[model samples]
Target: MFEPHGPKRLSDIVTGDETWFLFFIIPPKRLNRMWVDGQGDRHVVLRPGFQSRKTMFTVFFNYSGPLVVDILPQDTTMTATYYVQSVLSQVKSVINEQRQKVSTSRTLYLHDIAGPHKARATTQSLWELGIQVLPHPAYSPRLGTM
Candidate 1:
């Protein structure tokens, strides 16, 4: 469908996703070096057994570059309501402001089949914003078996 438009079609496509950001990262042993008087002064670095503190961030980008980056609010999970009201809304405004030349109605959105991305609220919101969602194929393990 986009063969005629080529690069222009690619430029109109926007993709978004969420990822966790660790509050603390353990440095590699090579980078954890320190000056010591002797071998006795060396200490063992114990890796944490428990999960570290982390925050989720939603990022939206197009062919040009990033359009929006939003941190999830503290103590809240990413739900359909939040996806529509927070993430998508911010992306909409940023696209309008930074990419004024691109028509919002022709903008194609791409994202994985996450629960929030497939939710009714998110679909309605995208429709209201005049952004078209590109259909993502669902992975089927059964098909691979054959």
Candidate 2:
């Protein structure tokens, strides 16, 4: 389902046209933590804890009714190049089919992040599909997969 940032127009959510959206959820485990000992007479130490482990997922929020693809990896290993390539192929096929159905153009908004797979083939494939990749700024959490 779609929701506008400022206003909720019925037409926005139920556009009745083919709109392809790629939803990516990347849960990055905060790599590591470091600490320094302060000069104190037997001081107690404290450190912040990370609550969740790193995981990535993708969802196709097809705006042409309830079309969803819950495709995800079964393994819990680190992200690999093959996995990204597979996802790219799947997404490209979906977009092409969706565009054909409603007789209209398509748009894509990719979340900005750096990784071996994301930086490689995924970017090039989207561009070949005439998809617009969103620009990402350095050290910016505000514009992220929330």
Per candidate, the number of residue pairs that clash is 0, 0
Q: 1-146 in candidate 1: lDDT tens per residue? A: 57985644777889989999888656567655767786566765575343468899899998888899999988999999999988888888888887788668878899999999999999999999888899986788887788
Please list the residue runs of candidate 2 whose C-alpha ends up more than 4 Å from where it truly belongs after superposition.
1-56, 62-70, 76-80, 101-106, 114-117, 136-146
Q: What local distance difference test score does each model get? A: 0.85, 0.45
| Local accuracy of candidate 2 as per-residue lDDT tens digits, 33-140 | 335568645434232342433334554444555333433444543243544565555655665575566321245444446463356566666567565554554775
Could you tell me the lDDT of residue 92 within candidate 2?
58
The C-alpha TM-scores of every prediction are 0.73, 0.42
The true-versus-predicted C-alpha distance at residue 53 of model 2, in Å, is 12
List the lowest-lDDT window of 10 residues for candidate 2: 10-19
lDDT of 2: 0.45
